[model samples]
Target: MSNLLSTPYLDRYTVNLTKKIAQNPDNYRAYEREPVTNRVLVSLLKKIQNSPLLVGEAGVGKTAIVEDLARQLLASNDKLLANKSIIQISLANLMQTSDGESFAYKFQQILNELMANKDTMIAFIDEIHQIVGTGADNQGSALDAGNIIKPALSRDDLQIIGATTTKEFHQYIAQDGALMRRFDLVEVPELSFNQTANILKKVSSQLGGEITVSQEVQDQIMTLSQRYITDRFFPEKAIMLLDGAISQAKLNQRLAVTTEDVADIIHADYHVPKYVINQTTDERLANLSQRIKERIIGQDHPLDKLTMKIINREAGLTDSSKPASFLFLGPTGVGKTETAKQLGILLFGEETNFIRFDMSEFKFASSSFERFKDKLTTEVRHTPYAVLLLDEIEKADPEVMDLLLQVLDDGRLTDAYGRVVNFKDLIIIMTTNSGAKAIQNHHAKSDYIKNDQKRQENFEEQLEIALQGDGYRPEFLARIGAMIIFDVLTLADIEKIVALKLKTLDEKAREQGFHIIFEPSEVLQYLPSFEYGYEYVEGQKVVSSSIAKYIADVGYRPSRGVRPIDDTIDVYIGDPVAQAIIAKRAGQLEDFNAFIFRALGNPPSLTSPYGEWQTVISRTKEGNYEVI
Candidate 1:
C-alpha cells in the first residue's frame, strides 16, 4: 500500500503531524503500520460514532483502530475527507486557565461548535478517565455527555466516537444505561511477529537507511523478544533502534547495517538479558569410536561395538525414542568421569555438558532419584542437551540400585516432587565400583546383595571370594547400553593426567594476564604416577602433594597455577624470594629456574578478591619478557 499522505495542515494539528513525522518510515527504524486484518475493529469504530466509548489495555491500538475506521469511512463516502469532518478533542488540553466563564463553559463552547452542524460532524472525546476530578468546583460533579451530545444524535445527525485506554472510561462520560448501550466494544491484539517486523522495516525506511533484516534474523529476534520485551507501546523503542543504527552507521561511515551492526543495536536495547550461545554440540555417537580410542585408551573393540549399538538405536537407526542408560563397572581413575564429560562436550558442544552426581552423597536411592529428577528436567529445558553423571554408583546406598529397575526399564522416573523426568532425551552414564571385587575389599560388601533373606543369613561366611564382593543384579546391570571398563590408572596415566591438568591451569592463568609457564610438568612425566598416584580412601580420591604439593611448595610460580590449598596437598604458600625478584627477573636461565624452584611447594589458594571483577591476562613473548 502507498503512504497515506492526504492529511493536510492545521495550526492545531501541528504537534500531531510532527509526532506522525517522527514515527514515520525511515532507515534504521522499527517498522510500524496498519495491519491487514483489522476488518472487525473498523466496523466496531463506525458503530460507536453515535454512541459511548470503549477502553482496553493502555497504548494498544484503540485509537489507531478508530483512525483506520475514520479513513475507511471517508473513502466510502468519497466526500467526507474533503468536507467539514471528524474532530477529536482532549478536554484536558482545551480547558483554559481563565475562570471568568468557567472551563466547563469553554469545553461546552467547543463542543457546541463541534456539533453546530449536528448532522455532519463526529467528535471523539479522549482521556475520558479524567471525569472524576472535573466536577469538584460545583457546576456539578459530572460532564454528562448524554445531554451535551444528544442534540445531534436525536436528529440522526449527532455521532461521536470516544476512545480511552483506562477502565474508568465509563465514569467520565456518564450517559448511563441507554447511553452506554449505544457503543460497540472492540479489541485489538498486540502486534504479531510479521507486524512487528514490518513496523521496524518502515521505521528504518523513514530514517533513510538501506539496511533490511532477513527472515532468519527476524525469526531470532521474535523468538528472543517474546520472552524478554513486554508487549506495550513500541513506537519509542522502534525509533530508538533506528536512531541507534543511524548513529552507529554515521560514526563508522558505513552505508548499510551488517549483522554485526544489528547485534550492536539489539545489544544496546538489552544487554544483560541476552545470553551468548557457546560452543555447538556435535553428536557424541558420531565420533564415539575416535574418542574411545583417545580417552578410554586400550579399550577399543569393547568400546566401539558397544557404542555403535547404543548410538544406532538412539539415532533413529531403530524405531524408538527411548535411550538406554549404562553402568560402567570398573576400577577408579579409569575413564568413567572423563568419558562422560567427553561425550557431553561431544554431543552438547562443550566439555562441561555432564551433570555429575557423587553417589557418596546419596545414601538412599529415593533422595538421589528425587534431587536428580528436578535438576535434569530444568537443565534440559534451558540447555538443549546434558550428560547425567552418576559417579561411583555402587557407593550410593546399594539399595539405590533398586530404584533403577523402573528407570532402566522405561527411561523415566517420578520423583518425590511429583515431577516426571523423561530420560528418553538424556543419555545417562553411571560409573560403579560395584563388581564383586571392589565392594568386598571395602566394608560395603553387604550393599550389593539383592536378597534381604539371603543377605542376613551367615552372609559373611557363605560368600565365596567372588560372591563376597559388591556386584549389581544381573537385570540391573543389563540396562546399561554399553560398559567401558576403566582400568586402574597405570603410573603412566597419572603422570599424563597431572601434566594435562597443569597445562590446563597454565592456559587459564595466561588468559588471566599471568605470563608464567610450567616447564617441570615434563620432568615429572615418569611412569607409575598414574598406576599408584591416586587412591580411593573411604569415599574420597586422594592424590597427595607429589604433583599438588610440589606445585604448592614452589610458592610463587608467578602465582598462576597453584591456587587451591586443600589438605596442604594440592598447593602451598608463596615464595617470598621469588616474589621479590619476579618483577626484576626476565629472560635468563637463572630467572626461569628460580621461578620454577620457588613454585615447588604447596601454596594456599586465594579467593578472587572481587566476586564479579576478574583480571584479564593476555600473553605474548614480546609483551611479557624482554629476555624470552
Candidate 2:
C-alpha cells in the first residue's frame, strides 16, 4: 500500500519551493511546464507595482500558485512583516444571492483587519468577472466595480491576484482600458491528458491509498467526462472516483483496484454530461422501455410492439414540427395505463409529464363541446410535452370523440376563443376496459344455445362482441399506431413479475444497509393466487385494482413479503381459516416441498378450504417430522 505516498512532505500541502527540489529531502510532484508558469507568477507577486492578474485554466492551480507564493513570501523574506495579509475571496457566491451587495463594502474593513494582524495584503479574487457591473444602485460597466477596486490597487503595500478565463477576461475587464491598465494579465492554458494523469496520481499518493488505476480506465473516464471538467472540476472528480474505488476494494477484501471496478463506480455515482444532448429524447424513450420490461414481465411481443411506437414518437422530437399521438385499448387490470405513467417518469425525469384525466371526469363536459377546448388548452400549457391520458375513451360521449378527432389528426387544437394550441411535442395515451366482456368471450366462448331463453343470453354476448368488432370504424383504429391488447397475466409472467418485485424489496433492504436474500419458493408461492379473476383475450391486464388487491392480500399479508407456508398471511388471500392450516408443522413441510405447475392442482394442493397446510413444519421424536 505504501508504493509511493510514504515520502516525507509529499502528502502535506506546504513545502519549500525556491529550489526545484524541496528545501528538505521529500518525494514530490510538479506539473507539466507548470514550474515555469509558477516562476512567472512568483515573479509577478514580487513586483508590488501595478495590479497583478493571475489567470489560468481550471484545476491547474491558480489558487494554489497564490497560496504557494504567499507561503514563500512570508517564510522566505525576513523583512516580510507578520502584519502582511493574504486573503482569499470567492466572487461567485456574491452573485448567487438575492439583493446583491457590492464586494467593495468590506474592502476597507478587510484591509484594516489584515494590517492589525501585521500581514501585508495579497487579495486573490476567483471569478472576478462576475462583478462586471459592480455598483448595485446604478447599472454601470464592469469599470465601476473595477474602479472601486482601483484604490486598493494603488496602495504601496497591496498586491492583487485576479483569476479568470481568457475569454471572460477579454470581454469584461480587458474592454475597459482604465480597468485594464491597472493590472497585468496572465494566460493559463488547459492541460493535456498526461498532465491531468500526473496530478491524479499525486492525489492518490496524498490520500494514502495505493491505487494503480490502469491508463485505459483513466482514459475512458477522462474521455467520457472531459467537457464537464472545465475550470478545476476535472481533477477533483477523478481523484474522488479513484478514492472511492480504493475504498470499495478494501471493503470487498480485494488487494488492489481494477479497471472494471472503477467504471461501475463511475456509472453508478456520476452522471457524465454529454456536450449536446442530441437524440437524447430517443435514448430516454429506450431506457424507459427497458425499465418497464424490468418491472412488468412476460409480455415480450406486446411490449416490443408498443415500445417501438414510443421510440418512433420520441424520434419525432428531433423534427418536432411533425409529432405523433397514441391510443392504448385493452381489458381491465392490464398494463395499458401503467405503461403511460412509467413512460412519463422515464422521459420527463419524473411522473409529472403525464396528466391523466379519467374520461368519466370529463364526460359531463362532453355533452357541451364548446367548453372542451378551453380545458385542454389550460392543461396543455402547464404540461407542454405532456401525455394526456384519456381513460375510458369509450365511455366518453360521442361529442367528446368529435373534438378528439382534431387533437389526434393535426397535433394541434383550436380553442373556443379561436386561439390555436399546438401539440407538436405532445404524446397522447388513451386507455379503457372498453371491450372487456367481448375480449373475454373472444378468448373463451360457447357457440351452442338450446332453448329460446339460452339463445337470448347468447345474443347479448354476441352483441357486446359486435360493438368492438369489424364494424368499429377503420379511421379510429388507424389513428392509433400502437394499440396493445393486454391479456390476463399468465401464471408464468405473474410469477416472474412477482419475482422482480421481491428482488426490489431485497434491493431496498441493501440500501438501508441490511442483508436480505429470499428463498426462491417464498415469492413463487404468490403466483397461482392471481388466477381467479383475469381472463386474457386479445386485451386484458392484471395490473391495477386486481394487482392492488392481489398485492394487498398476498404481498403484505405476510411479514414484508417473506410469507411462510403458514396461513399467517391474513390480509389479502381472503381466507383466514386456510391461513391457520398452512402453518401447521406437518402441513407447512408438505407445502414447501410441493410443486404445483399450472394444471396440476389437487394432489399437490397448497390451500384447503379451511386454511393453508395445517402447519409449516413439525419435529418428530427422532428430531425430524414433516413440512405439511
Candidate 3:
C-alpha cells in the first residue's frame, strides 16, 4: 500500500495533501475540528461507500476538516492511512476545456488513476457541486464529469471526500440519486461562541511576532463577529476579524492589538458606527430615554413606557430570542415615526440605522407580501442591530402580518431561499392609526384637562378597545412588548415645535448670508385658537369661557397632524425668506440686516379674525414691512 502503482493523471491535476502538510507542519495546527475530521476518516475506512460528503455552511470549516485529517494521518499508526495520501483534484486545472468529450476524457483518466492507486491515494474535491454539469456540451448533455465518475464511485474503488455548502449539496448533488447515495454525509455545524473564542485564541498565539492580541480583544472579536457579522458563520468570521486587527496593528507599527483595532475594522467593513463598536453594551443603553426625548417632543408618557421595556429587554429580563418589540398606537404626526427614528440614533448611533417600511405598500396580494419579506430579510441580514419601523401596520395584508408574527415570536425569519435572518438585535416598532378616532374623540370631550391621569387611563382603554375592533388578533397584540399610545399634541408642544421649525428656517437663511428670527411668543399669539374652554390651576382643572389654544387650531389636525404647521412655515417664512435671499443675490432688493417675525397691532378691519394683532415679517423693530 505504501508503494502503489504510478499515478500520472493524479500527479498532473491533484494536490498532495500529505506533502503540503510535510512542507509546513506549523500551518496545519489542529483546532476543535477534530470530531469532523475523525468522521471523515471513519467514512474512508468503511468497506462500502468509502467516500464522505462534507456538508455545512460556507466558512464553517469543511475544507479545514479535510486538511486536519491529512495532518492526523501523517502521524497516525493506523495501517489503512499509513501510506495513503489525500490528494485534492484541482477542478480548475481539470476542467480546462469546455468540450464535453475533452473534459469527460480528462476526468475519466483522473478517476482511473485514483482507482489504480486507491490503496495509497484518497481524493478530495472542494465545491464538489461544480462537477455536476461541468464540461457539458449543452444543458441536456448527460455525459458530464459527474456522470463519468459515477461507476468508480458506485463500486467504491476510489475514496473521494467531497465538500460543498448545504445549499449547493441540495441544489446539485441531492438531485442525482446515483451520485447522492455513493457518499456518506458528514454534517459540519457552526462552532459555538466559546468554541470560536478558543479558536481565535489558538490562532492569536500562532501569530508569534510583535503583533499580539490580548485576551479581552480576542473576546471582543468573537462577540462582534457573532453579533454584527450575521451573514457568515463562526470561527471563520471571528478569525478574519482577528487577522484584520492584527494586520492593522502591524501596518501601524504597533506591537499590541487593542479593541480599537477590532472596532476600526468592523466599522470600516460593516458601516457600523464607530461609537457603537467601541462602546460597551451598558454604555449604549445609558440615558436612553433622555436622549430620545431630545428629538421627540410631547411624547413623554409614551417614551417612558417604551424606554422601560427597552431597558428591561437589554437587562435580560425579557425573552432573549425575540427582539425588543413595541406597537405605537397613536394619531397622525404625534411623534410615532420620529420616536422610532430617534431610537435608531440613540441605540445604534446613526439615523440611517432606522429602517422604515410603509405597510400600506404591502396591502395588495401575496406577491407584494413576498417583496416585503425579501426587502425586510435582506436589510436585517445586512444591518442586524437597527430600528425597524413598520408604518401603519393595519394597512398591511394578513399574509404580511403572518410573516411578522414569526419574526416577533422567534426573533428570526427564514427567507424564500432558506436563509435565516436574525432579528434579536433589532428594535421592532409598528405604528398604526387604528385608534386615532377614539383618541381624537376622547380629547374632544369637554372635561378633557391637562395632566388628567384618570382621563389618560380611560383614553388608553378606549384605544385598546378600538384596536381590538379594528381586527387585530389577541395573540398578535399580546406578542408586542408594549403598546404605547401617543398623546395628542398640546398648545405648549406646538409652540416648542414651532420654535424648532423656526430655528431650522433661521439656519437655512444664514446659509445665504441673511439672518432671520421669529418671536415665538408673538407668533403663537397670532395662530388661531381651538374652540375649547379649559385652564389649569396648580394641579386642579378649572372650566373657563374663553377660547382654548390647542394644537389643532394652529394646524395639527386629526387627519393631518402638525403638517399644516410645516406647510405654513414653508409658505410664510421659508418661501418669503428664500425669495428675499434670491432677490438679494440678484441685486433686485436692498440689503437687509435681519428679518424679524413678530405680531403687531393690525389695522381696523371688520372682516379680520386674527384678533387685534397680525403676524408680520419686517426689517425693523418698528413693525414696518419694507423688506417685502
Best by TM-score: 3
Candidate 1 per-residue lDDT over residues 530-597, each given as its tens digit: 24444333556544234433433332221122223222223321232234235445533233221121
Ranking by TM-score: 3, 1, 2
lDDT of 2 by residue, 233-347 (tens): 4455566666776677676767666655665564455322121122255566656656877755555556777777767655553444433556554455456776777666656
TM-score of 1: 0.44
Misplaced by over 4 Å in model 2 are 1-61, 64-106, 109-123, 127-148, 152-159, 164-195, 198-232, 246-255, 258-302, 305-333, 336-628
Q: How close is each model in CA RMSD to the real structure? A: 15.5, 17.1, 6.8
Q: Could you tell me every candidate's TM-score relative to the true structure?
A: 0.44, 0.38, 0.79
- Model 3 residue 3 lDDT? 63
Candidate 3 global CA lDDT score:
0.79
Candidate 2 has its poorest 10 consecutive residues by lDDT at: 595-604
Single out the weakest 10-residue window by summed lDDT for candidate 3: 543-552
Candidate 2: residue 76 lDDT (0-100):
49
lDDT of 2 at 356: 85
Candidate 2, residue 569: how far the Cα is off, in Å? 15
Best by lDDT: 3
